[model samples]
Target: MAPQTSETEQVVDLNSWLPITASRKAKWWYSAFHNVTAMVGAGVLGLPFALSQLGWIPGIVAILGSWLITFYTLWQLVELHEAVPGKRFDRYPELGEHAFGPKLGYWIVMPQQTCVQVASTIVYSVTGGKSLKNYSMVAFIASTIRGSHHHPATYGVRSHTTAGQIFDVLNGIGTIAFAYAGHSVVLEIQATIPSTQKNTSKKPMWKGCVVAYIIVALCYLAVSISGFWAFGNVFAMPVFDMLESCLVQKLHFTPGRALRFAGRSTYVAITGFIALCIPFFGGLLGFFGGLVFASTSYFTPCIIWLVLKKPNRWSFHWIASWISIIIGVLIAVLAPIGGIRQIIISAKTYKFFS
Candidate 1:
């Protein structure tokens, strides 16, 4: 039999289709918007709060350091996506599977990626609900004032105990981690762009990503600086695709509108309920960032790059990878300590569905 062409291979199959890999007609600008949107969501708003906890120097270091590290890791992921000719690792776990053994990589990466998506949905839900509520209060105040009113903005005031300050710094690191949580879906976003043998997807995807990161830097710089001075904040629908893929591809269920509607709606309802239960997630930024986002966005790519590239000893890539991993692991461990503490504190006063 003759080798099938890439065109013959890419024919859409609804039965085995997943949302993230379904669309392959996006232009470079689509990636710019998608990445910008993915990278600048609920977490961006928390950066100010994150900066406040870390103090001036440490916080600046953390922000600039994270930006640089994440950018490098992102480049590594893009290069690896098409390292093998004619094959693409669309999902993060797929890349992990390539670097490590399939089962081991899946186990190592899947949990972290899944957690990032699930936790993000919960955070977004809380942020969305509170935003409207806050807007209403502002609107009411405006009505009474009859014009624009400037209120004193209190940011970065340190009044916590010694231990509390420590926890806050750790939490702040997690918040910073949260802000750069874009790695999980980089390949997924790139997958949308059309790739050819002559012109691979990475070229266009990287171009767009560069733009997105630029926007991220501009927004974060002002937000983070002003917040500390002032304060500071993905997947292309991974949760939906993951669930549908499991049902349709893993379990051999038929893929159709009904299944999608039911599954997607259930996911929404669950995330909403969790959001309602918490009602406030300001403290969760660090917890989720450290617990899972760091693994998915910060260190996982670095580890995979080291495994696959095997850069020479003490080389630039090698040293940078190690440094990133070290910091990422610390953030994963220490940031979550404060996050869990914050959760416990919040839980004590939190009311169910109130």
Candidate 2:
């Protein structure tokens, strides 16, 4: 026998079908953090590649385009929030169904959303891995400097070393993983906000959106400015720019003892940094979880709901999702990792102002 829907389930389902919902004030900070994290991560991972492939002008253009896209998305969400104050944007599919008919609604949004999630997941995984390696290397260098009391002529920072290339690949994987990992928060947001709780106050949700955007923008600008200033012409990656600029090398103390001490210190520092990064890598794992959630929890359920409740027709959502997933997996498996990196750089150039 089919399981019966409880009152809570019924309420959740109803809420899930609405267009927008009021978010908690406390969650505003969380949203700000999320936006900042995403923007910085993207900039650090994307900027160097973009600059190398498309030149500086194109790279700047791409950044601008990405910003504009983000702005438009936020605007739409705010408008939807205003229209249906008690629901979330995820429920917009249902609203589309109500307005444009089920078939049209599913076709309009699901495929685009799925693609965005997939792209996001890949970027997160790749970038996260790179950040891990970059930070680890930084710790290693710092330790070495401290150990060698006989100040080395150079702090050993190089632009396009083999080590940098390896880190770049790792960063790409981390970016993908990070993008795919974290959906529990999104799920929690959907679950906790009641359908009946509308924002009756005229205080625009856009205020919160603007605050979140500004926080993110500042973080991006800081990292970008710091990176460019430090690396100048030699900056090969966003993380590299930050590292080159943010760290300072100093020489003090007796040579022999300092050398020994610095070596040990570097070792400890490098190890600790790597250890700390394991949790950040957890974000990549969360991205995989997000992919599963997007596929099974989101797209699948939506398809099933449409099939059962309204129309009984095969649709593009299923076809496009499967195709995209297949293509993504094939690309992940078959494409040379370097090739993928190049493609990402090229695509960023083509799509954005870059």
Candidate 3:
């Protein structure tokens, strides 16, 4: 048998194992976009309905609270980055380990990360499905209006008359799928940024964070306004509210073609957009895989590395992707759409505590 590796060698190996990879680096923009998208996506889509339920002041307050939480979390992440110059914020568990003891860091952060991943996934899947159904209904309505006196094609597309239970399920599944796709993007971002030997100035990074926050805030606000105005007391998803808003007005140039073929085509196109997002479901699965890497693969191993001060060739990165895929598949099969929705929405409430 070969001589046993030294403890020093093991620590080096572990450090190398956790080093940010290339794939994450290459797709930084997409990852950043995913961050923003996941944060605001379903929230915006359902803001109008939520606003109607809670009223404007309450809605605004909730959104403001969300923004405050986002700012605080992001600030903490930045501080972590500053504290450890070379480490990536995506590897939050490592940062925690460094600041707190290894056990404390792992115990505190790992579970939180897991909760975030699972909850975000559920929200994405559920909202995505609801958005799809809403757009489908819009398309159906437009089609009927256009083909009223002409050739009526029996597409069999009906409005969503499903019970509350079914609606909840589909929404949750869609939300999870959305969150999963989002997590994958974060891994890609974490891998891409070059690991610096010394701490860099936080100005540029902070600027990016500020811009992102503002954009997210505005988007959420717009969706909330548009959704509530359109739905007017109907507790529908924000996407449905937006569609309803869009349908109310006629074209300035073509007054006679209010509900014409062109209008129907536009509605269909919107529905198609939602349909195309089905691929994102797969993306979400990949993201959850990345989270598994961060949690089981990255966080746990890093803790061991800290204590052992040695590196192991076996790293969490290797199996993280596959593990995520498996979990996602199992969830897809076993949970059903409703279960997914419940998980996602329930997770959303955690934002209050986060």
Q: RMSD, each candidate, Å?
A: 4.8, 17.8, 19.1
Q: Model 3, stretches more than 4 Å misplaced?
A: 1-32, 85-90, 133-191, 195-204, 234-354
Q: Which ten residues in a row have the lowest lDDT in candidate 1?
A: 134-143
Error of 1 at 301 (Å): 0.6
Model 1 lDDT tens row, 112-222: 888998888998888887775322223334433432343335544353688888988888889889888888888889888889778899988888889999988877765
Expressed as tens digits, the lDDT of each residue in 155-182 for candidate 2 is: 2222366744543443333222222222
- Provide the lDDT at 326 for model 2: 45
For each candidate, what TM-score against the reference?
Answer: 0.88, 0.43, 0.46
Put down candidate 3 lDDT per residue, 209-279, tens digits, no spaces: 56666766766666555445443440112122223323443322221244444554564455445434432
What's the best-to-worst order under TM-score?
Answer: 1, 3, 2
Residue ranges of candidate 1 with Cα displaced over 4 Å: 1-16, 133-157, 228-236
Worst 10 residues of 3 by lDDT: 234-243
- How accurate locally, in lDDT, is each candidate? 0.80, 0.37, 0.41
